[model samples]
Target chain A: MIRRDLVFEIGRTLIAIALALLLGFVIVLLVSEEPFNAFINFVAGPLTTTRRIGNWIEATIPLIFTGLAVCIAFQAGQFNIGAEGQLFFGAVTATIVALTFQLPMYLHVLVALLGAMVGGAIAGAIPGIMKARWGANELVSSLMLNYVFYRLGLYLINYHYRDSSAGAMVSYRLPETSWLQQFWPPTRVHWGLWVALAAILFSYLFLYRTRWGYALRMTGLNKDFAAYAGISVSAVIIYSQVISGAIAGLAGAADVLGLYRRFQWQQLPGYGFDGIIIAILARNHPLGVPIAALFLAYVRSGASIMSRMSDVSAEMVAIIQGIMILLVTAQAFLAKWRHRSVVREAKKHGLNA
Target chain B: MGSTLKGIFSVGFGYSMLRVTTPILFAALGAVVSEKAGAVNIGLEGLMLISGVTGVIVSAWTQSAWLGLLAGLVLAVLFALFMGYFHIKLGTDMVLAGIAMNVIASGGTVFALFVASGDRGISSSLASKVLPTVELPLINKIPVIGPILSGHNVLTYFALLAVVGVWYFLYRTPLGLRLRAVGESPDSADSVGISVSKMRFLALGISGFLAGFGGCHLSMGYVSWFSRDMTAGRGFIGLAASALGGVHPIGTAIASLFFGFADALSNYMQSLSIPSEFVQMIPYLATVAALGVFARRQMSRERKGKKQAGREVA
Candidate 1:
């Protein structure tokens, strides 16, 4: 039975991927005359070079953090849509600490990471507290927080932390002591990948093995039933949010201290939204998040390489991602296919219901 | 200082508020209709975004604002129909589908921009035409209020008319009742021979039409061109207003006006030497505040009901 289920899951994933590719190909054929070249570039461009592989790893690091963050909240039935805002706040907080301290390299990095956690926690807790205390919908609160943090980041970058020499909305460079050590030479990929892996392992353990985790899952599945069984539903919701926020913040810290030389104020990177897609595709499983993140990162990296290699725009990859998401989220189509297959098998066995 | 204060009042902050509210009013009304039919259309943002681009593109190409408005609405309606087919017929999660639609719309517009014009953002500098303001000559001759009400974009007038139109449709019409019945209890509606799915699809289609017009107003009426992600968070803001307004057309109109007033105030304050960043934060801050208030009220009502049940048992 287990083998059958695994096979079915793999089949579903493959089918979805195939459909997405077909749709993307059709779009490309319509738009570009050199469709075959574009298709080849889109599929194989990222695999051809070492530097591109490094870029994939670099992109995957933050996605791993944010994806895991989203997974935790989603599993708890709390859609923490504020990951983008939380990431911004996290990066800013880490930037502040990384700039202020002149400690040892390891200590500086640790402090920056901790600051990111705190920043994310505070930002994440707002919606959680509002939901718990007053019944404010977490979805709206979290989404609104994205705009707030975006403007706040802009304010800080433009006025308070401005590196005037940069000539735009940017901040001062962090001290070298705070910088994360690189994993490979000539590539920007750093130790953040290891940190992300550790986070994934920790999240998996926390969700599947712990008593608290079980209770949190119970609460998520049915608040009324969980309350009847004497679980503190509100507490679990709040805790899940804070943890999710911290993870997202860590992602921001990883980006800033591990990669960027100086803080550039981005309104909000679509990383949070990407994380949402990852969480959904992974079915909110901690172990599945990293895989999904890697897949998405690979697509992004591949698309960039393809853009460089051929006339096809990298934006075509986004179109594919959107179509895939639409198909996956609309499970009715999947259900219909499944129903048809089941009916056909039953007919063959003369066991029609 | 007194003269400045009077100028602030006389400068028609109310008109500015109305101008800002127009797009939101259309969007909030769309949300009300959709929500009343049991389909949560979180894709309002995407619908508006795509419509905005379509309106700008068509207008720029044809040099006709009306053509742009029509194109935007038509595309919006088609998108709504697609969403309805996926969610109502195919049983997709509304929120996820909405998010996907948004991402597709945003990315698609940017891609199309690159294809249409070599620019990655803020469409062709060919100086596209905008919807002209219609001046009511006789009305303009009236007092201060006349100038405030008259000489506005045609879409603005349409938005005002939509408030009453939506209210009447939702309250007085049989179709509206059926839509509400589905929203309240779809199982019951189904048992009574009402096609819950059909009603939902129709509601969503209407929603898409309204949202498309809203987008047209944003691009053709207000700015005359499309910029990347130019709708910003107005669609989401409209959703919030719809919720805060208790999903009623009149209430949503009021809420939209309040939000628009906040937006206009921020813009006005920015002109008075205030930091633009700080000014920009006002609308977002207001959304949070509104949500906080709405949530608190809901909690208190639940608590009160619980207390009443406890007293009755005693």
Candidate 2:
């Protein structure tokens, strides 16, 4: 059963990816006057330039962070959808630390990033605590909290931290010392890449090797059995949520320190939402997050190039992503392959058919 | 201070609250119906987006707001059908499919906008036909309360009428009973010779129509122009209303009204020294509060039921 399920998942993902790309190509053909050029650019653009590849990696850093966040909560059977808001809070908190105080460069950056994590953790806990205490649905609460976090962050920057000279609702610049050192010279890929890699490794180790991770996974697989075994399911839910929020916070901090000199968001940076797709593609495996994020980042960068080089809108890529997610999750999509794998597995076990 | 209180409690505030509830009520009604059919449609936000822009473009092209509304409703229903196909027939996770649909709506609408109006930000170039407000025939001539209730957008009245329609459909119809049965337990409904998928499809179809109307109300009835992400979080707010109100049409309307009042209050409070963002957080905050209360009540009830069952077993 397990082997069959795994086969179906992989098969479904491949088919979905192929379908999404094919559909994207069809749309490109219909819209862009130079359809062949547009398709070629979309397929091969990011790899053609080292700078573009670096940009893809840079984008992947934050994507993996949020993806890891979602993967943790989702694996624990918690739908903590408030990662988006937690991320916003993270950015806001990071901005405050960057703008408010003075410290040594490394200390300042570390403190600011920690501040982001704390902020995200706090925001993430609101829904978790509610679910633990009152049985309130995390999905609804977290989803609603997103608006609150976004609006509060917007108000904070627009009202208090507004850089008047910027001529837009943006925050004051961070100290130069607090800025992350760019690893890739030509592109903005910074130290966040290393931090993200560490985080992915940490999550994988935490999920597989740790007792708490086993308990969390058991709770997810069977709540009643986990409870009967004396596992505190509520604690697991809350812990996973808190950690998820921290990861989201780290994503926000990376966005501020690595990508932008100041908080310039007029809207929620959609990394948290994108993380949903990434986490699903990862199949709730923490180690799979970076790989999934890398593929998505590649497609995203390709779409950017295609839009810039030809007459296609970058927004069209969203359709591909949407279709990909829908198709990948469709249980009936690769049912035949799943059945065949099950039959093969039974034969290997030498069971009388 | 007294003047401030008076300003906050003015008839204008009440009127704005009603207007604010219009789209929410439509969307919430859809949420209630779909959820009652065992399919929770979280894609209302996306549906609203697609409908809002489609309504605007169609209204602009046809030079008739009514036709535009129709087109929007049709398109919205089509998207809902897509949701049903993916979730019900194709076996996609309902929540995940809904999320994907929202993404599709967010991006697809902008793509369409860029094609039709050559603008990604707003559909301002399209001279879209706006739905007109109508005076309540007899009520407009009445006293103070009458004027407050009268002269609303036609869709506002339709939103109220839809509550009645939803109530009647749920309680009075055999189909509604079957749909509710599916929600209560699909296996039980299937054993009773009811087609669970068909009922879900119909429920989703109805919900799509209502959500589509809600989207139409935003673009045609309220602003006449479609902006990207203009549905904001109202679709989710509608879902919250349904959950908070326990899937009852009247209860959902009341919940929607409370959020609507918050929305209007936020708009009004923007002129004050208080930041509008904090005020904008009210509807979302209210949703959280409502969820907490509902959860508490539900948990207590379950505890009582468990105790009773234990006693009976003993």
Candidate 3:
């Protein structure tokens, strides 16, 4: 029965993806004079070059981190949107360490990332604690905090840490030793990929194998039941956000260290918002996050390529994303079919007389 | 410091506060309607963005500000209905669907802007019409009160009217009562023969309509051109305003005025050698703090009530 349910979930996701793509194509056709060329580029352009594949992987790494972050929070049934703020503060903390500390190579990288995680955890904890302790709406507080932290990060970068000679509002160049070591020679793919993959594994194991994980999932399933079962639901909520924030912080550090030379983000990098879509698409499962991230990254890469080669803008991908999210979360989209399949599987396994 | 204090108390500050509050007040009223119906429209941000851009473009094309306003309102309603269809008819989570709408609006507007004017940032090249300002003859000559009250954008007056209008609609009308009843308890509303979904949809439509005015006010009255992200966080701030007001229409208008005052202060403080970033952070920080305090008070009240109930049962 579990197997059949998994299959149906995957099947529903696939159908949703297909419909999203189809709708994307129709939108392109309406906007682009050379609709065929635009559509083809959107569908096939990402696979056209090694460099593009590298770009796709780089994008996928951050999504993986943020996706895992979102999955953890959602699994605890907390609508904490503080990941964006956490990621921003994390990157700022990472940059501070990268610039100020005089540690040796590996230690410098590790310490910077650790600082970032702490920073993000603090940012995440505020809204989490607020929600748990006072019953404040996590969604509004977190959204408000996103702006506060973003402006604070901008202030830190623009006034305090900016390299005067850089001409733009950005931090001093990160030391080469602090950079994530590139594992791929021909492309800029770095060791952050490995960390992201490990995070995926860690998230899955933690969620399914640990006592805290059981408490969290149980709380998410039913708060009354979890409390009756002697779980501290509020503790789970706070820590779920904290864990998510730490992972999101890791993502910010990795993306900065792996992809850029300095802290130059003027606005929220928006990876945090993208993470919400990935988490939903993955059905809040850590194991499914990377696959969903890859799918999003591929479409994003394709959209960018299409924007360059055709009349269609890269923003077209957002339409696809919006459509995909709406369809996937539509509970009744294939409810009857899913129910019938579950019943059939039960009958076949002699679960029902 | 005295100058700063005087500056804040001056007529210019009051006038600009009303100007700034117009959009947020409209959005807050919109939020009040949807929230009262139990279908909170988190997509006000996207709805405003879509309508703001459309108002600019349509006014430019037709050479009539009213036509542009009408077109924008129509699109806002359609998009609201689209969100409604997903949340109400298709069983999608309202918040998630709203987020999706924001994503689509953010990207789709940029795409459309680029296509229309060959510019992705602003519609400066388009000759969009501005809504007229109303000047009260007698009030215009009334010294200190005159400047603050007289030469104001027409929409500013409308926003003030809308607060009272929304209050009346929610408290005085049968449809409004039904909508509130649905939100209060869908099962009870349904048992009473009220169509929960229909009322919710109507609430969403009213929200869209009010938000449409807010959008038009931004492009036509606040600024003469539509720019990328011109609404900024006004939509979310409006949500905060409505929430801070406990989703009451008159209370929301007052809450919006408070935020608008904060915004005006931020703008004013930039001249005082303060770092604009820190000053700008005030409103957002205040929102979080306000929500925390409000929630804390509400929870204590609920807890006390529960204890009293338990004692009664015992």
Q: What does each candidate score in C-alpha RMSD?
A: 2.8, 2.0, 1.9
Off by over 4 Å in 2: A1-8, A344-353, B1-3
Q: Candidate 3: misplaced stretches above 4 Å?
A: A342-353
- Candidate 3 residues B1-314, lDDT tens each? 67778889999999988889999999989999999999767899989988998999999999999999999999998999899999999899888988898888888787787788776668878999999999989989999999998888888999999999999999999988999999999999999999999998999998998888999999998999988778887888888889888899988988899989888887887777677788778878887988999999999999999999999999
lDDT of 1 at B136: 78
Interface RMSD of each: 1.6, 1.2, 1.1
Global lDDT of model 3: 0.89
Candidate 1 lDDT tens digits, B164-270: 99999999999999999999999999999999988998899899999998998988888777888887778888887887788999989988888887777776665
lDDT of 1 by residue, A1-353 (tens): 45654566656766776798798788878877687898887788777777877888899998998999999888888867899999889999988888777899788889989999999988999999988888788987898788888788777767678788877768898888888888797778898888899999989999889978888889889989999999998899899999999999998899888888568856687788899888877878889888899899998888787677776677777777877777776666567666776677778789644
For candidate 2, lDDT tens digit of each residue in B1-314? 45546767888877888998999999999999999998889999999999899989988889999898889999999999998999988899898989999999998999888878887659979999988898988888877777679988999999999999999898789998898999999999999999999999999999999999899999988887899889887888899899878899999999899889888888777667888888878778887888899899999999999999999999
Query: Which residue pairs clash in candidate 1?
Result: none
Tell how far residue A194 is off in model 2, in angstroms. Answer: 1.0
Report the lDDT tens digits of candidate 2 across residue range A12-118. 78888999989988888887789998888888999998899888888898899999999998988887788899999899999998899899989998989888999
TM-score of decoy 3: 0.96
Q: What is the C-alpha local distance difference test score of each model? A: 0.83, 0.89, 0.89
TM-scores for every candidate against the unseen true structure = 0.93, 0.96, 0.96
The candidate with the higher DockQ, 1 or 2, is 2
Scored by lDDT, model 2 comes in at 0.89
